[model samples]
Target: MENKKAIKLIDKILENLDATGINTDALIDDIKELRTYALEQQVPLVVKVLRLTYEHIEANQSFLIPILEDENDEELAEAQEVESTPVESLKYLIALTRNLNNKMNISDLREYKELLMAY
Candidate 1:
């Protein structure tokens, strides 16, 4: 049952990626670091799905070009605000993971969640 839910989550992530062209190499690196923490803390399954989703996005770099190119453009800030970025997607995943894993009392996880929220 959990595996089914994980698969559905991945599908939804991919769907959102297709609908919105937003992602970044920095976001992917951050997600990889997050996954490493998840693995060390025994939450491999959840982070693995997230890792796969980001890997898919990494493969589709063309879709991310516009967003990456405009990342520093002050004029694009307002337009970008309305669309979901990779970091925002990761935050939602982190929150969902926190809810799903009742045993998650990791202090680092809590700190990371706060940091992401702050960003």
Candidate 2:
């Protein structure tokens, strides 16, 4: 798939992930579609990150929500926004896709992928 199409798909997936109430079923479908695009583009890092993201959400159904809810608590109000971690990671993936010519972005992508895998 073209880079433009892949970026758009990634944006859509990010939108779904960042929504108020996440729908795991729909999110999984989007991830699978994005993974197919990554595979076609022959980008192994993108493919691996997408795969790990899929498995993480699959195993932890409410992974994003708890952090979000905690962020709403008064005690955590002063804390940095940890809830956006996953969303930020996806945004990095989007950045990586958009700037494939830039070798430096690959490190960010790899780092995010490692974080996801370690989670």
Largest TM-score belongs to which candidate? 2
Writing each residue's lDDT as its tens digit, candidate 2 over 22-58 gives 4678877777888888898898997897787677778
- Shift of residue 110 alpha carbon in model 1, Å: 22
Looking at model 1, report the run of 10 residues with the lowest lDDT sum: 62-71
Show the lowest summed lDDT stretch of 10 residues, model 2.
62-71
List the candidates' TM-scores in order: 0.40, 0.66
Superposition error at 92 for model 2 (Å): 4.3
Model 2 Cα RMSD, Å? 6.3
Clashes of each: 0, 0
lDDT value, residue 62 of candidate 1: 27
lDDT of 1: 0.48
lDDT of 2 at 90: 50
1-117 per-residue lDDT for model 1 (tens digits): 134444454444445445553546654654565556556557756565556645655776522211221346766665656554654544444445544445442343443344333
TM-score of 1: 0.40
